[model samples]
Target chain A: MFEWNAYLIIIAAVAGLFFATAVAALVWAVKNGQFSNLEQGARSIFDAEEPEGIQQDFFPGEADEQRAKLEKERRPS
Target chain B: MSPLLSFFSSIDPKARPGIPVKVQLSEIDESMRTPSILFLSAAVCWLVIGSFFALVASIKLHSPDFLANVEWLTFGRARSAHLNAMAFGWANNAIFAVSLWIMARLCKTAVRHGGLLIIAGIFWNIGVTIGVIGILTGGLTSVEWLEMPPQVAPILAFSYILIGVWGVIAFRFRQLGHVYVSQWYILAALFWFPWLYIIAQTMIFIEPARGTVQAITNWWFAHNVLGLWFTPVGLGAIYYFLPKVLGRPIYSYYLSVLGFWSLALFYNWAGVHHLIGGPIPVWLISAGIVASVMMVIPVIVTAINHHFTAVGNARATWASPTLRFIVFGAMSYTLASLFGSGMALRDVNVVTHFTQFTVGHAHHGVYAFFTMVMYGSIYFMMPRMLNREWPSAALIKTHFWCCAIGIGIMLVGLHVGGWIQGMMMNELTPDGNPKYTFLEVVHALVPWLFSRSVSGVLLTIGHIAFFVHFFWMLAGPKISRYREGPTLLLDSIRGEGKAG
Candidate 1:
């Protein structure tokens, strides 16, 4: 019966350790500026911007002439 | 056009040409082609195999004498095999393929160690095979989720370590300055799963905790397998594909952060609810119930984030196969989770515990929510990986409807029948005697079990269609001039800026 108490203590200690680790992680994240730029983080998925002046390949079935025409219409005079 | 009309039209983003994200995504998909294909194909094979086992098990429930003589096909071994196959073989493998691809793309890094990933995947499947076979051959451990014998656990763990480390390595070499919320969830899951698995194995099997503590450890591990392991990966995929398919970001970054952290903190503790009526202390059960209720914060926050993001985009969501299935899964996640919290209450748990209601809830979480989202992710992924449009929209529609309807019937039949069974089991006569015999209650469940078998057949059809269509796309030629863009359910939605 006393062994039950020992097992309980061990479980409690493990739970405490998990709680402390989580708090530590939260603190480290805050300290390291992980939460500073929320909007930028949201936008980060689209960070793969191709360089200007590179001729991008047209999607399948899209004519090159049509793409060039669209590009010309977008360019300033 | 009139000035007023032009003003309103200019404010609508959907009226504009779609963003040029697909080209960039294709590059990432190209880099991950080999490993992602291997994982996906293996996962589909397991899905088919698991569905077979599931059907057999469901049949035996209604007709016990059908295959009673076959040692390997007995209820105990077959059911355990089905659970492990679906959980580890199918779910883990699909997560490896989809989540790793998402991690690589979100980090802006081409997968560096593709060969290592394939090798790890092969070994992981091998381990699961050995484990399943061991269970059939009289080596069953009787542990709920850890039914895989001890001899195979080490190999499984080692293979998982190899696969999991690759995600961390990819993040270490990431090119982005800002880590997306999806990355945090995926990365955390990759770390948490092995820790939970190892600790549970040590306590339950190796050191062998005394008496009811073993039951405590078992429930803790089993529930965490669903909560920590499967839930995070499923949510990560939802966070990624939801935004990408809608061509927008998640509605509120603050809400996402709250949802992620609250889930991480509360879910691990809620596992104790499975032991609510057991021999454990009352305070422990109360803690589990509290944490289970606290889960509402994350569930509601995530539901709102996903819901608001899809608002006004119903047309596109309905038109795209990926978004359609994912939205179904997202809604299921919210409903199933809230229902789960309610089930954890002592009053409700009294009737639901040790009944088929719990089984219905488990399927709701694992199948309707997690597996549906995975199917959606695969639909989006296969096109990008193969650089071709799906050969048949009819097949995709067939797969979706079959699974949706099948799981729907199963959940309804199980819950309604289980409730009757539970209530009857709890009833007593005025003279302090039982109202119904145990066998009588068992006899009542036969009809519901038969309905479950019918649902199983529908799901099997869905699985076959999915696998056939997937392989057809793989072996077919790339997209040509005639079959140009990504396939959409609606013709008008084609060539729009939707990610496959």
Candidate 2:
């Protein structure tokens, strides 16, 4: 016997343990309100400086007027 | 219509569907700079080294005697060295820089002990350097993903834990509120990777599992390293950057949650598919196939989430280099995962198993999907971290086009070539003899392998441009204009502005 059966048993036990741990994580995530406030969670990465609406990235050759216009639009009035 | 200097059509910058936040990115960016610079600089050096090894290995496949005079550059050793260098060297270090920075930003917690991370990164790089040299000098192991000698394992594992803990610490002290989707992906990957690595090392190397257990364990570990470790880190970066660049939230938060959990649950089980037609139990193989097919749910879910978010912003995605790279990578993720699911079927596996088809698919996932995503992250992260824009937009464009075209050529050549080779090998004479002699098949594959090598050269050129551009920003003059302007992709290539 190559102890194949024993290996299977160990595999089964480990599988059960992982499943249980995954379930626990899911439960904790749900209970901790991790699943709530769905849209707000999506927006949480933004900030006042690099605020959400304005596109922060662009090429350097913007006409001076266009650049000034964007800077003005981005400022909090 | 009177034209008084275009009085009526005022510039109304189109606002993307975006979200607002409370904290300053500058504070978080400052916290990330110390550790991230060390990780990223080291990663760039490794990328160059890995690219060299990759070119050498690829060349040797078609022309075996090309480097025959040098023993270390033999195909077997060179190929393994390339994989180890890229995997442990470039990819892991990039993840440490990009994913960890994203975690800290989303966590809203400064990395408390930044010095610890620098130390861990040093040791990790040192360990990889040693392992790579050892592989070249004939200490290579039989294990697939764990090819690094037994001595290198402990150093990598310990250092990785120290580095991974910084992420966990940030999560622990996170501002108590909504856990962003990016944070979920980052956190899960951090926890999962170390566990998978440690278990794999113990089972296959430390104690040495017996009989068929070793083979099974090897595939289990190797496949999951891609599925659970690299895939999550790459996906997490995509989720974070897409929104930041496009100024929009993910299309559906609930669907993101679904995508994440399903990926975590099914991916680990999918590893056994690598052992199809092996001596493993039929039931085990079936389990793997089922899990791999089930992966389509999350892949499609993620694709929809990202595509819709970036749908109307096509022009922006093209103009902004960061968005350009990220979107390409995201699209590749969908293609690679679908191709993977298809290959997992019994009939498909029978054809693709040991052929160049598998090799092509590996690059599709690892390079096209993961590596490109990392490139996008570097382009985004470096400007913010250095407080300066990229030095040359032309070079960035060069890097992107070369890599995109290179990998595309590679995929077509390898897959198409492999399919023909596999069919010829499988052709049986009436007496069940192989129809094509092995030498004939080898002769047939020369052109495809040469195409792969050609792609490697293009990729190496792209890599060099990226490497030079990275340092140029860090070391170049500290002019005020370059400091303020973000390098973009719109300017005419010849007469580019001061950012040139």
Give residue B229's error in model 1 in angstroms: 1.1
lDDT of 2 at B26: 59
Worst 10 residues of 1 chain B by lDDT: B491-500
TM-score of each: 0.88, 0.90
For candidate 1, write residues B114-141 as lDDT tens digits: 7878898899999999998987887889
- Tell how far residue B473 is off in model 2, in angstroms: 1.6
Worst 10 residues of 2 chain B by lDDT: B8-17
Per-candidate DockQ versus the true complex?
0.14, 0.26
Residue-by-residue lDDT tens digits, candidate 2, B1-500: 46643422211111112312233565677778978988888888888898898898888888777878999988888888889999999999999999889998887766655888999999999999999999999999989888889898899999999999888877876774787777878888898888778877887787776777778878877888898888988898998888887666778878888998898777878888998999888998999999999999999999999889888666667767887788999999999999999999999888888889999999999999999999999888876776667777789899999999999999998999888888888889999999999999889999999999989999999999988988887787766353335522231121123222
After superposition, the stretches of candidate 1 with alpha carbons farther than 4 Å from their true spots are: A1-4, A47-77, B1-24, B479-483, B487-500
- How close is chain A of candidate 1 to the true chain A, as a TM-score? 0.57
- Candidate 1 C-alpha RMSD relative to the actual structure: 10.8
Residue B393's lDDT within candidate 1 is: 74
